[model samples]
Target: MDIKVLGPGCPKCHETERLVKEVVAELSVDASVDKITDLMKIAGYGVFGTPAVVVDGEVKSVGKIPKKEEIKTWIEG
Candidate 1:
């Protein structure tokens, strides 16, 4: 699985990225987690909000720090 966390390195963005990595590690899912910070790249995903989560090229969350349970559901689903 491919997961991308889009942000420009804000605190919320950092927390979001951290939570994503934590969940991925705990689940032991074979996935690549990437942080996309470039404005053009983030826009390419059609996400105007920072701290967006994209899984398998699909937008899952945007503009908020999703809870741990939410993150887990995204990973599992």
Candidate 2:
């Protein structure tokens, strides 16, 4: 699975990345996580908010640090 965290290196963004890693580890899922910091690239995802989570090329959540359970659902779903 492919996951992308889109943000400008803010605290929330960092938290999201960390949580994503935790979720991936806990789930034992093989996935790639990429931090997208470039403004232009982030905009291409149609997300104006920071700390967005994208899974498998689909935007999962944006503008907030989602809970671990929610992230796990997204990852597994």
My TM-score estimates for the predictions, one after another, are 0.96, 0.97
Q: How do the residues 1-77 of candidate 2 rate in per-residue lDDT, one tens digit apiece?
A: 99999998999999999999999999999999999999999999998698999999999998999999999999889
Global CA lDDT computed for model 1: 0.95
* Collision count for each candidate, in order: 0, 0
For each candidate in the order shown, give its overall lDDT on alpha carbons. Answer: 0.95, 0.95
What ranges in model 2 sit over 4 Å off? none
User: Which regions of candidate 1 are displaced past 4 Å?
Assistant: none
Give the candidate number with the greatest TM-score: 2
lDDT string, candidate 1, 1-77, tens digits:
99999999999999999999999999999999999999999999998699999999899999999999998998999
Model 2 Cα displacement at 31 (Å)?
A: 0.5
RMSD to true structure for each model, in Å: 0.6, 0.6
Worst 10 residues of 1 by lDDT: 41-50
